[model samples]
Target: MHQIKRRSFLAATGAVLISPRLTAQPAEASQPGSLGASVTIEREPLHALPRTQYGHFLEHLGRCIKGGVWAEGESEDMFLGGIRRELLAEMRAVKPALIRYPGGCFADGYHWRDGIGPRSQRPLRKNLAWSRLGQKLGPEEDNHFGTDEFLRLCEELGAEPQLTANVGSGTAAEAAAWVEYTNGPKDSKWGSERVKNGHPEPYQVKYWFIGNEILGWHELGWQKPVQYVETLKRYAQAMRRVDPGIKLLASGTFGPNPNHAEIHQTLLQGAGDHFDYLSVHLYATEWVAPRNLWRYQILNRQRRPSRGLYYEIMAALSVQQQYLEDCISDLRQFSPAGKPIKLSFDEWNLWYRGYSDLYQSNFNLRDGLWVASALNLHHRYAQELELANISQMVNCLGLIVSTNQGTFPTASALVFRIYTENVGDELLPSQVDGPALPHPTGLPVLDVSATRQGDTLALFLVNRHLDAEVSSRCTCQGLQVGTVAKRVELHHPDAFKYNTYADPRALRISERSETLKVESDGAASRFSVQLPAHSLTCLVLEAKNL
Candidate 1:
């Protein structure tokens, strides 16, 4: 039988104590995949921007809150060392610019003070929205993991905090006080309390969400458009007076649907001017029949259509973009000079298909592919979107799964790691001019992101082809290439193979120089590369003057 243990093994000691078994995994399976020929990456002049809109969310539901990040009992590790280690690892992987917490639907009823101070002394409150017990889990949970803990974690993870304020079942004062507690330093009682709790420095987190999913059909029944707009306006104005430098995100409906559009329009008309960003939520799933598998074989038999995972991928993204465009258009109709507000997809992931329901399901191949596709979609649209959190990053709908006792990286986590590592500060321009791969259902041949590091051109390619490898050329004008440096890939024959503590390398990056080739200087000198079926490739080229 396999065994697991935890000791004071220090990778970055004093900072945190992660378990040893957590990082150990079996050897990667042998690689014998075919590497055919040389390919050229055409020289292109690039004007790219930082992908700041890349953000993440952490919720207090499922394994996310209890066993995922915080351990209640007194252990040598104050903040649950194991969970801290897992969080650090995930943060390193996703490289998220911002981290939103204590929510999804949980934020509406969240009390900031309930999860602080002494763990046992904190009272357990009713979590009406996302409790697994259908009632309070215990006497009332101590506020062991509260604002201080979240900000501390954010600081440790090198991410900006995106605090969600309470709107329903909470007054404007409680919300404003929270902003003060985090941003305010030791000039007042709350600030003193923050210092007394071990961190003397003010967090000064800049992004705040007024509330979450207020437009959902069965939300706490807080308000209709006019009321929501009024409440949000009051909350934003009051909170801004407390800390004017902070950016407030006014919640918007995810719509085109009647319910979403009505509330969306109302919120825009009511409080659009007082905010820095517009928040929206979207998750794609196939909750039925041939779409969702029989649970048992889900890790194996599941396969996305040759074209794409779901028809709704394009539809959902299109709808969200359209919604934001229309909302902004409506806003500009009145205040043409109003500050532009981009989309913050703070909550999104591959849900439905019972995949979301299987909280502890190991990261297998199918999940990894979906995660890769979703992130690719985000990179493609990064110009308009400001923040995209891969909803619930640990335990529940997580990129990594952990119990207070231990943790395991999932396929989804690997996808985030691969994507974040390859794409850099400059999002370069690229054209996937190959013949579009067609299926009974529509599917594009390639999913691509081009970026430049100095004069070196880097391309992140996701080939969604099921059978045939896609052969294509990238032509960039007014630049010269010296040599093709390296071509690396993350691929496996079984798209669902997962990394377990026992075998972590099941789906990892492999390097092969033979898979790429370059021919220099001419219209016919365009760089050509064959994107393997269902694989992700990163190609880099060094520049040379012609």
Candidate 2:
């Protein structure tokens, strides 16, 4: 792991090194009559970008657990806890802030008891979530990877464990018991059971989700808005009785829909005081077909609209961000006085049609750009979005894909690495004045977020344009720019390009030193750089006088 230098800023100069495949047009081919994009960074600091925003999720579905992180058979390279040593190493490298376990609808039907106790004695149960619709039921869950194992994995990776308790098929007593086992004192009954399970000390997990999408009809025991709110209150009350310090996240909306409004209203009115965070899930997919069968048939017979899929996804993300803000406002209006509710975007990613049989999504360079933009959105809305988890951590919409042979870090993983490594502590507001992109609702060609820590500042930018490279001038108002500290770019010639085991380097991050020039007047220093089309870049700079 490369340690990020805390105090110093490094700079890189020249045109960004672009992959030959992606750079079909020369840098001189700027849009006709287009002015250079300019970004102004405000000195006033927003709240610290919560570390918890850099979290990941893990579910029991598919190879994410049984074969991905926890290998069944022992090998020389396996960790002592029977997990894949290679996966652990990869997870540690990203320094994920949290890992939500046993879910994404799976939690709604899961029975915590089935996973506790001796592995040999653990029973194999049918997984109702990840199975084919009408063919075979889901695979058998051996109950090998349960609560304890999850806590251990979090410990190994220095991540907090965010457990989603079963509210669909399990009762409040069961949820309370799981909490007791995890955090109750030694004298408590379930705590004693924890000792019997060979863990004498409590896991002291801080984050817990009440349920996993219980309002969705596809969930195991889907409930109506009112019913789910009542259940959430009961579960939150019971679990808090077991451990009062734990933070509970109530399952929120799927998106900006009528059900979303009703659900949030009911939860805030009925159970607002019980939970700390409202969990929401966001997944974007390109328009594959028309809504009507005739239109779809006609469109399919003609030609699929391949262009602007990336921009469409980005526009959807922008809409989702607005929806989230509206939800937060509703929470404020509905909650009791002095009680506040924040957002936990626990599930988010670019999920589309091409998923493997094992539920793994083929993440591509376009997806990496989407991840970068989505992360910037989170940072932009950092105040309301207290926590977020990128759907799954391994093999299932994950940044890292695990196989029988080894683990491969996807292009999206490099985005995670870059942000987690380079982003500063406090988010600073930044505005970009640039030419508009044709798609994705005419969003600016340059999307940016800035962060500051003492004398250092980091800028994260995503050029949303598909065909034109953006030349942008950045000016920091309050801070004097001394030097360029580091420049990291993640891009490829082909937006659809993805990483595979055969050629894992197909889309990866590149680092180069770029020149930084101080403005002649020295009032506010500026830097110039060209942002590649469909790319994400991070630039670190040092403050001159601080």
Candidate 3:
């Protein structure tokens, strides 16, 4: 039997050994010893560079609508500092290229006209869907934040506005008029009215969605596939006639399956060419765990529920992907549009629990690292998937969490902010290798992706191991790598260590660097990296181009 030495074992696996005697260097040291031998890496070029805007979304659910962008005093006259400046600043910091608004299910029952006009005149309608505490039940639904408010917020945030037209419980005319109000120039009545409201500028938001999740009616009423598609088609036609520059997206099903695929294919066939993007939702959690306690529950929620649980989830993801494939596949067969229809995975997060009356949770360090891992998945698959949002932006499973007094960045948000900034736009070629190391629970080793910005190459690594550490060599192919420019890691002894506004550092990308080791030859260069078990790290490599 081959016996591994203690140092070799520790360095190879990149672990934080629980045994008291197993100390190497401090956790912050670069040369924490070495494994038995060096590993060789082959070269490969990354492809299908996606635009940065491929990561964004909006849903007027949870605190996202009430306390988030729709702050209290947005209007000139009806002002009271309702919007959270700090929260807005945090979101702006993310540099979202586009933001869809006004609903998740909230879009289904929304009346755009109600959210317009004078606050005093705006009628009070019972928010049947999201009001868990019955907060909007009394006099709170006076409609403080309306169309004008959202447009202004968009401008302030420097993001493209993606408004969802009311399809369920609304007519095509209502959707058209709303577009006219936002995009129409000053001469028209609606345009003039917008000018009179305080701002004379036409809010030219070219991207719009016909409806949001109309097929599912949990809180809001549901529309059958045919009805939803037809309504969306009508809305698309009228919206385009008013502003031909508009980019529209049809609502795809919740996940993968023949039913969902048929729904997407049918919808696309009816209104495929008219739209520019398709919307879908995905969440990683134990929601799909099997009933057998052992079968369903995995030690790590970040990974799929062991192998047994993923059987359903992967099938679901496959269903969603096939639907997307079919939409474009079918559309291309008929319409000769230059660009393929893109995907907007607008609503997604690791939602296992915590969706209750409040719908908010302070994600721990493990959750944060997982958030980064999921985002890395987005970067790797950027060719097909574009515009992915981590569900709620602020409170309520948001990247950033809030309190009645103040707000702070969540672990997930921090990781996302770091990953996005470095990897945006600079497309390069990269790849991952290592056998599929399955956990005792049966999930495979973590996933990773790479990209480049200028001469800087970014390597995003994720370790999905729960109880054990993974020993794998990550080798970048083809490029001549220099010293490691920066290294940021998010990890903790416990997966549940989270950040609070007062002590946000409780669990974070606690340490980072602009230094590392790079070795190469005339043919190719490689940077050595060790991903901590159950953690995520980004290795920045500056290439020496010949």
What lDDT score belongs to each candidate, Candidate 1 first? 0.60, 0.75, 0.60
Q: Put down candidate 3 lDDT per residue, 67-178, tens digits, no spaces.
A: 6545565433322346666667777777776666776666766788787777888898766445533453112455677777777777877777778877766778888888
Flag regions of model 3 displaced more than 4 Å.
1-45, 51-58, 68-80, 131-140, 217-221, 288-339, 426-429, 435-437, 440-446, 467-474, 510-514
The sequence of per-residue lDDT tens digits that candidate 1 reaches over residues 387-463 is: 77767677676777666545667777766766666666566555555534333323455767766677676677777
Better of 2 and 3 by lDDT: 2
Candidate 2 Cα errors over 4 Å, as ranges: 1-35, 132-137, 288-305, 354-358, 520-522, 544-546
Give a tens-digit lDDT track for model 2, residues 1-546: 122121110000000111112111222323433336999987888788988999999887666776787786757667745677777877887889999988877788789989889999999887766553311224678888888888887887889889989987889999999999999988899999989987899999999998887776656677888898789889988999998999999887765565566668888888888898988876654432212234334323322233434455556566656667877787777766788788898877765432232356557777788788889889977887889998778987778988687677887888899999888889987898978866526677788989888888889989877667788998887678766558899988777687887887787788987777767354667778778877899998787442
Using TM-score as the measure, the top candidate is 2
Q: Rank the candidates by lDDT, best first.
A: 2, 1, 3
| lDDT for 407 (candidate 3) | 71
Least accurate stretch of 10 residues (summed lDDT) in model 1? Answer: 9-18
For residue 119, what is the lDDT in candidate 1? Answer: 59
lDDT of 3: 0.60
